[model samples]
Target chain A: MDRIPILRMGDFLLVTIQVDMHDQLAMTLQDDLTSQIEKTGAKGVLIDISALEMVDSFIGRMIANISGMSRILDASTVVVGMQPAVAITLVELGLSLAGVQTALNVDRGMQRLRADVAGKEADDGRHQE
Target chain B: MAVTKSEVIPIRTEHDIVVARQAVRRLSVEAAFGLVDQTKMVTAASELARNTFIYGGGGTLQCESLLEGARRGLRLTFTDQGPGIADLSLAMKDGWTSGSGMGLGLSGAKRLVNEFEIESVHGQGTRVTITRWK
Candidate 1:
């Protein structure tokens, strides 16, 4: 599909990459997420990729890019549901995906997102005080 | 070293890369590849497909099911008639991309497969063959 659906819940934006995304589609998602985070003023982003069967170098780079973009936009990004085989292959492929945060599933991902945002807010509060 | 089944998919666009990966996934399953092996094969196919499209300037991905006695394997061959790679050794090095890529396409693909072979002529074309046994 040309577009991946981005859902909003409170201050968090959720995205599930369910299909075998082509390179263009992956780039589109990265751009779309950046805009969504800005437009919604989202504090956190949870990207569910449990359905993703493979995280090739391109996909791996996209995920890392999304994570970086979200951070620079003042939003925390968490990638969830990576298949075991995909993870293994990614390592073998030599993509460490450094600077990308990951969680086991949607539940854990959401939890981590919430915690990270909350932690950021706490630091902000301290700064303001 | 016999191909039990084979199919060639064109790698002329981004969508074609997805098609090649899907074809490899299905063929890998038919060969009874484990989930990890199937994923690895498909991932390798993706890297090669991109090379065929981006660096090689469009090509074809050949998916084959191989049978060797009691073992079954999946093989993917990517070919393109583009300007070909001028430096095979440097091109194969990690973190050295000709374009704006992350520079791990060829090297990473090699790590994900059991067998990796490459052939290229500076002015002619390039061919990359990779295989994984189940």
Candidate 2:
């Protein structure tokens, strides 16, 4: 029942997803975050899937969508803290993320987000020259 | 022992995704492989399943185990009778995605497996083949 939390860490946006591992809830949460990515335009988004016990196709595609759309919206996104079981399941199902950036922990994801934002900003500045 | 196993599993909804994962795991475990091979196969299958359902509306996943003279491996084939890919090359490129994919479906699957092939015809459907070994 607890919704995903979106917090701004400097220029980056951290999304803390508290999952119940329930199928229906995972679907709901994924939909909610997908829309949030569009509405907030946060520079960076991090998803904490540590509490998640399982992720089906719907949720998997939704996560992929979130990361995909975030780029279109000019925001960077990373998935953090996936359990070994969940990671293994994802691999077996061939749902392994191709473009979505993932980090071992929330801190590392945030650091990467910060770096990504800085790199993009630097690129933009150089292009303006 | 030249024992070959092949079956076409359907992917209708999200639950089917779990079944697909299980099938792949069983195949990998039966071969007595390590975590890396298992992980790669699983990851590649996951992306293909997602693509089949999302883009193809629904489809079938075919898995074949090849054990030819001590060379043990598995081949995964995903087929969908949905709208075929318009641009195969671009779709395979990283960061290029259709619908909600993170632009990693095809390319990501490619990296996870030893061999990858995709055949599609516009307005027809798609067939993706991937292989992994012990």
Candidate 3:
């Protein structure tokens, strides 16, 4: 059976989820990824979900959960390479993700992460003012 | 307990899930909840509404605004009159599906929202309530 792969990129972590993304597998993937992000203290995380064809409510919720939990851990999360069909379906299903960040590619997602970090640092500097 | 307006939408067929989910999301957005809460409520309602049409043959989705002092949230109640689940425990288990189902409906819904509850009898019917707070 294929397994989810984790890649370390600088202070960021990359998680490649290779599965049908159905039922419990989807939920388990979210739970495990969240725990890993918390354990590693990574600055940011990237998720590649391009392999998924159909995303039911389970997968949508899992993605939302991961993004939400990562915030508590102080790690920003970005999802990359989501299929257009999946995006369309999510909108149709009313799964709008406002708190989570998303990008069309990993590079863009990383850029966003860097920007977030930079912005946070700038905010902190201002807070000291 | 935060009390808000409740809307009851009748489900006549499988297509009604789309409408039900849309209504729930719109209400969540209008109530000033975050996108995550809206996502959870929508996904949970999708599962329950699908169950209503596929298993219950038809039902209704009741959406109510939730507020707890300064906090805000939403709740969805799905009711169906079709054949109720035979075994709730087995149905909750992963990969144990009935009628070509992927078997993630109920359990997935539960995980999406902060609060979830379900009640059903073999033939009486099924009622599922899910809530997400902002």
Candidate No. with top lDDT: 1
Worst 10 residues of 3 chain A by lDDT: A19-28
When sorted by DockQ, best at the front, the candidate numbers are 1, 2, 3
Writing each residue's lDDT as its tens digit, candidate 3 over B20-129 gives 77788689887786655565566667778878877888988889887899888888888988889899999887556786665667876776778888899998899998
Ordered from best to worst lDDT, the candidate numbers read 1, 2, 3
DockQ of 2: 0.10
Alpha-carbon TM-score of each model against the true structure: 0.97, 0.61, 0.55
lDDT of 1 by residue, B1-134 (tens): 78888898998887899898889989988999999999988888999899899988999988888999999988889999999899999999999998999999999999999999999998899999998998
| Tens-place lDDT digits, model 1, residues A9-73 | 99999998888898889999999999999999999999999989999988899999999999999
lDDT to native, each model? 0.91, 0.77, 0.76
- In model 2, the number of clashes is 12
Q: After superposition, how far is residue B102 of candidate 1 from its true place, in Å?
A: 0.7
Which parts of model 1 are misplaced by more than 4 Å?
A: none
Pairs with backbone N, CA or C atoms under 3 Å apart (clashes), candidate 3: B2-B67
Reference-based TM-score, model 3: 0.55
User: What digit string (tens of lDDT, one per residue) describes model 2 on residues B34-98?
Assistant: 76677567667877887898899889999998896878999899999999999999998876888
Model 1 interface Cα RMSD in Å: 0.6
Report the Cα lDDT for residue A55, model 1: 91
Model 1 gets an lDDT of 0.91
Candidates 1 and 2 compared by DockQ, better number: 1
